[model samples]
Target chain A: MTKKAICFTAGKLAELGKENIPDELLSGKGLVYSSPATLAYNSPGAEGYGVKRAGLAVPESVMLIVAPGCCGRNTSLISNMPGYKNRFFYLEMNENDLVTGKHLARIPEAVTEIVEFLKDKTPRVVMICITCVDALLGTDMERVTRKAEEALRQKGFDKTRVRPCYMYALTREGRRPPMVHVRQTLYSLLEPMQKDPRTVNIIGNFAPLAEGELQRYLTRAGVTHIRQIGTSESYEDFLKMASANFNIVTDPEVRAAAEDMNANLNIPYIELTRVHGIDRIAKQYSAFAAATGIEIDDTEEREEAWEAVDALKERYPDLTFNIGESSNCDPFELATSLVRYGFKVDEIYATLSPERFVYIKNLARLSPDTKVYCNMEPTMIYYDMSGSKADITIGKDAGYYCPDIPNIAWNTDIKPFGYQGVRDLMNSIASKLEEGRA
Target chain B: MRGLRKVLTPFAPDQSGAVSVLYSLGGLIVVIDAGGCTGNICGFDEPRWQGAKSAIFSAGLRDMDAILGRDELLVKKTIDAASRIDCKFIALVGTPVPATIATDYKALKRMMEKKTDLPILTIPANGMRLYDEGEAMAYRQLAEVLGEEGNENKEESETVIGQTPLTYGMDYKDVSLEQMKLLGNSKIIAASASGVSFAESMGLRYEAKAEPAMKYLTEDLKGKVLVCHDEVFGKTLRDNGVDLDIATFFTLHDSIAREGDRKISEEDDFTKMVLEGGYDTVVADEILRELIPDFKGKFIDAPCFAISGRH
Candidate 1:
């Protein structure tokens, strides 16, 4: 007997209610399949700005990953990249170290060795990345990092700061996941400085956000210095982020960090979610204008976004999509927005959460029969894409699954957001579809 | 500074090696980890995972699950997955989480066996050990659980053991389950350090030679050449008239070990060897060149996926 991939329609999911969501749809319920979509979530270091990359987001920083050899194996992919060269070091833990917790003792010496080894390229910060082994052992990393700092100080390198970042996959479902924790750890480095009204820091996203109306909107409202960690030139330049009046949080994962900033540095924050729907973008911008007392007339940008959508619609009037969670945009929101634009969505590959049920409910109203496949489900091993009628696929994982279909891996480190994101995505789809036809 | 690695990232661990062996063997391979270990194996370690689908999964053990030592839940999850997925057998590969908790693989295997009729192969690979050890363990477990007694009627074919992508890179040729079952009767070839270890452990009469390394045997060398890869690769090169010394991070069997042939575990060991060996030519993965940038030696490129993942 042939087994099939398990899938539920948006309507069926909406009817099931969030509390009654199937175990297969929600992650952490069963064994997780190593699908490409799940790789980003499963192995945080595999793709994008995971704990390893995010820890090094601070300018002039190097990381020392202290864990079992397996934890740091995938880091070679990141290490080989041009930007990450000479930045990553390792302190591999063994069985004896696991038992005695002696790796913690060796970290200070290891940190000193790494700093001495990288003499001329002396780092302003050293991030100590520990994995689940420490998470299980309940190792006091904060004290260990302080000890490392003191060791550096005693060695006449007092300027060097040491910090610990957790790569605890076991605590992924907990309140503070590794991603969320890393953001907090990075932002916590910012010391309180005199607030500048013109300066605003964009918190979240290790890579710079796409040049769009979001930055333009802030700049048009008399904002002079717009700082982002990705665009910061040096350690001193990164330190200037401490003077920002407020933070504009782009990702939800960074909200805890934003809260920390609010408490520690007295920097207020405004959260803007990355959405695909033009209406939602407009509403979010309007809300932003109202809260910050910054008038954002998004009429031109809104029309431009809709124009791009219409242009794509004209070229492929009955275009259908297969969306995956590996993209920048939420699969449910993107699916719902596409359906609202009179385009068909055949399938969505993503893990479901109760917080995302609102989008699923909205999607049910627009596209009831759209099948939702959990990318991490054990049954996804049998996922056969032959029956799908998707003309195009969005996201890297979707591209992997549907090789024949024209795909736009909109999962670049450079994020897409707001009105410009919608416009760029629409044009990208049209361009890719044209390329496919050619 | 015992495990401080400044030049190279850590190589693929035992769990990854174990998975690499059992990847295509018609089994539901489950890594007893909290997603990251499984992700590292599929995303980085296992080159075959790209564009290929396998039944490899993470047990998805949470903090409480590991803290409380929930073996029954893991067994239930495996049984549930096996019910839906078509597989000939089931394999449980261990990682740091299991190692930290001191997970009893024997107990877990016994628990799963009662619920499901499928044969269970348990590889207790702590993530601390290197890939070669894990591969040898997997090969040993496969032979113990699946190997059949000598058959009089069946035709004997030479089965290659431990020629996985982790060791052979692009030249990896898989040994199927049927071939693995005939280990007792068929002639065996130990393809790498792991193969040699497995062959010796099982007391199987086998030819110890790396067929892939035979390609490097023809390279013209001037002076003393230092070959750093799997031990058998170096041995194969030496047998075919290469005046070389073997320095392997993997295994160095007594049969393959010659004078000056060292078993290295750190970056400094390799650096010291290259500096002191006085070799005119060094043959290893290009990634190792980062360690000895000052060494003025002719380097011959030998891509070992386990060392550099260059395939």
Candidate 2:
């Protein structure tokens, strides 16, 4: 099983037709086989570090990752990442613990000791990140965390709280992915408070959004205080998240947490997906404005976004781009947008998510010759690039399959939202193409 | 709840450790569960995976396929992958879902044998066991399934098995220094990710029970200041005139840290002894050398996989 993307020409994909192409992503029919590409897909450069890496976003809060030593070994590398030193702890399980489930009993004491260990400052929360071991063992972490909290209180650390977050990879494709659940788990820390309509809390991204049009638009809409979990200066500032009048979920993963906030904290949220198309993004904003009674004039942003797109078209008029599924935006929709802009988009490498179907149908109608491929498919290793005409690739996974090709590892910890996202992507692609020429 | 983890990231399960045995070997390693098991191994647990070139895929067992036993699908996919790559063998590793559902691996192996001529070995990794057990099991299975029939002359293939990073950090260099001459003709099998000797190191640790390695170490060693890990020390150091009284052993695990009189509870214990005890020679992991501000002593860089965990 070579771990490369399955290479197929646009003509071949067109022949196969959209109806015949397997919906392996959302359908859950993952094509498993021997793999070398799996290595690249899971590499740190590819941002393959799971939710545990993202879950540690809360400032000053420590994570006690309970699993066997094997599971915790990688954290040593992660622990070495800036600011992670000593913030991550472990309560490992052995053969006896795995069978007798005795580790659960020791967790409270472990929490107690961890709390005591962090004497310099009383951490706001202790996130208990559990894995598939508990999924199989069926350990009720809620009850377990309740006991752990009691132990923390027993130790007289009244300022802190212990909460459970599931890292059950087995349940990743279930109702909510592990990253989504972790978002909810992190936000669940905020207790209900009186609404401050002037304040807006942004949930979803672990990294703070760069200063963009959105911040100015929010300010114009009378949003005086914009608090994002990643940008929150302190635990107290995070606690003040409950005071936000509404939540703006920049990612789908955090939408579940937004729903939880709406139910538990009485603060409603508007969900917006990051897209490259100026019109699609503008329409989404209009929908948000209609829903929330907030006027958003994205004319300047939209015009600048088109200028970048048109400039790219003028320079790389005959460019054939390779888009991929592993990036922040939907590869299918991104492909559709590129095709619409008259720049050749002949190849797309992405998993078949349900939302993909919307863009897939459109691409099939407009750009029927565009080839669709799954990165996880076993046959991807035999992807011959000889016939597939491609100049630049978009995502890391796509770049991985297309060796010797200029690729923008567009996936990042930062949120690239709306018209600014389009402008940024066009500039990045243009610079990369110029570098290739030089 | 029978066994749920609250805060702990899933430890390196047997499935991941099992992957280590075939690390450098040009073999197709497939974890039969879902994406997470494979992701956990390739992404986090196995440090050698980055910039690596090995065919390790997850069966991508969907909820329905898992609910209903679908070993045929896996067998078909394995054949397609093996046919594409030049793998020496195919290793099928298991996870929690297969064990809970009781997926028959033996039958799956038979089906796999029908499709490809390459040797197919199944590593029993149910996500329930630790890395040591999984690794030990992988070594045993590889020895039996992949071992070639040989003549009675054992010297021809003097292999030291049961070596891996799990027990020994990058400390094998220090450990090997003590017995360089002793293991000159011999080669380490699977201490860590070395591309040879797929057997495990625990065989040496538990050799006293029945194996001959301990007996071999006993007759050769004269009384001298020795520092070794706890796992192998208990068995090998128990030799006549070679007990813990003559040796200082360091171990992180409290349960197996003791051998007669000597016990090293913490890393500081090793630091204190090495500085003051004035030992003539030391046999431990090379990582300890970094802890000492400066060192002027005889030390063997031994790599033990068992004690390579966070305290």
Candidate 3:
């Protein structure tokens, strides 16, 4: 067996130099590609928030993260992030409890105690986020949650609910990523209600999808009650989501949960991938309209979104860019869209998925030397584009990697979609580009 | 029920503490687990992660790789990573899954040693215990590997060992310097022990982050007089009393085999030792007030990460 010398940790090709590279380096041969996270990977990306922050997207939902000491330690920093301080709770798993499964029994009483303590604004759902320790112990959280629900009912809080979200990092590389499982779990709580054909539910994301063009489009189509899981101000509002005509799976990772809801509740869903290209956005909107049999006249908003992008191009022609992997925008698709707009896309720091190959292959063909590096690769520590001609950068990860450069994080907690998303993104970059390093 | 932390998260486990000791030493540290362990360590617990270049990685352990007991794949991925980057050594920190399956890390370490000359250290951290335990084990393991301690030719300046965020909080670097500077007049280099009580000896400015990191790295154990924090700092402070040492530990058995200061077994014992022993000041974390109620001596606060989980 020949020991092939290929870079596992990410490094710039220019830094490695051409002469040191073997001729068979880029050859599609018998090799395995892996993405073990690096320092760059630590930057909060879209894989989903920390366990403490995940289920808290709902108005009155609190998360109880159960693991050994180390598993819950990092949550302190995340606890300080906005909207997360009061909602997160923890249950530490010590050696004896883990070995004997003693902690599982305490979980029921613990939930009841937390509910009673909250006294004023009782939590609608208590999300028990289990970590890898439980995965190893093979602890049945489903049974544990059921027991907690029954115990809570016994305590007179008959309306309260308990659900489990798995933070099984071990299965991150498996068929269903952990975040996908989390989305499925969060949305599964909405039980079937009487059908209301005029309503639509925006599935996925904890950050509210508020006041976007998508909402306006739905409103124009006689969609009276548009609901989002993350925007529910009360448990009652969240429960009302079951009456929607159809579910719009706005985030790609939420498709699994949407499918589950469709199968179980007979509430069908249409998937929408957030994209930056104006033409592509239009096509997606048309497809969504066709799927729902609702006529959405979004021509004014679409033209306005394009006008914003065109204004930026006119002011700054042949601008070079570096796109980050973080945020709602798909890196490959976004990069390809930027390239198609006659913008000089310098490089992209993104992880490659099999579904994104079309964009990657097209990107390679259009800009042959465009570098594609995975932020999770350990060698990303050495990513230095000091000599590059790119004037501005996009995305938080990109901003960090290419420091001292004019960049835009372009990151908002709220889900960005459709024509309004284009306006928001382009507007953000345009304003930040003036400041250069904001 | 005492240190339960029902609402607050556990401060950190021993594995993360062990990783903190070696990460700043400029090596490619890989936590041999799924991604979350690495995330918690680098992203949260390890404060030096921001604005620093450390080659830490997750093994990206998947379901089958773990289920099948694939040590070879770990070895190969590690080797591939090492070949691509420049690292002095490799520390494979274990998580619960590997420990449950009883992954033969020593065998894997031996294979790695055979493959290349990189000094391999395996911290069999099962993610069950707290940070101080991990720091203690990692400190000992790394000491054994690189314990070429001979000041025969080198400068015998006053030194402080295990000076990192594991022992202190975000202000570890500043606090460590302050502790070392207090010992500047004395003709000794203070090599700090692993646990939070060692920080207490500096005066309880911080809460004990966790249980002590192995009682002490004693004088008999290493042929150097490892005196208590009080005996050295206490003498200089009669009028302008500077507490040279305030020796207290989480567990009683952790007391070092030094002569000068007696071991403080409980809160009352701590009070008696201070009042009768002619100690003018008590320096400890403010969080310790819950434990040590009758603190009559002048209080100088030191913060500890272990007990400050509510903060």
> What is the alpha-carbon lDDT for the whole of candidate 2?
0.66
lDDT of 2 at A65: 73
Task: Estimate TM-scores for all models.
Answer: 0.98, 0.80, 0.81
- Residue pairs with colliding backbones in model 1 are none
Q: What is the lDDT of residue B224 in candidate 3?
A: 16
Segments of candidate 2 deviating more than 4 angstroms: A1-20, A23-27, A30-49, A384-388, B1-17, B44-52, B62-88, B95-104, B110-118, B126-136, B150-311
lDDT: worst 10-residue window of model 3 chain B? B218-227
Query: Which candidate gets the maximum DockQ versus the true structure?
Result: 1
**TM-score-better candidate, 2 vs 3:** 3
* lDDT tens digits by residue: candidate 2, A1-438: 454455454444445555665543323454453233343333211143456676778887888877654445456556656877667777766557766888889888888877776777767788887766677777899999999888888777787888887766566567976777888888988898888989998788888876798888888888899999878888888889999998998878788899999999999988888887788888998998898787899999999999999999998889899887667678877898888888778787766654456676677667777877777766664566665688988887677667778888887768568888999999999999899889
* Cα lDDT tens digits for candidate 1, A309-418: 99999989999999999989889989999999999999999999999999899888888899999998898888888989999999998988888899999988998789
Relative to the real complex, the DockQ score for model 3 comes to 0.30
Best by TM-score: 1
Ranked by lDDT, top first: 1, 2, 3
Q: Give the chain A TM-score for each candidate.
A: 0.99, 0.92, 0.87
DockQ value for model 1: 0.81
- Ranked candidates (TM-score, high to low): 1, 3, 2
Determine which window of 10 residues in candidate 1 chain B has minimal summed lDDT.
Answer: B147-156
In candidate 3 the C-alpha lDDT for residue A278 amounts to 86
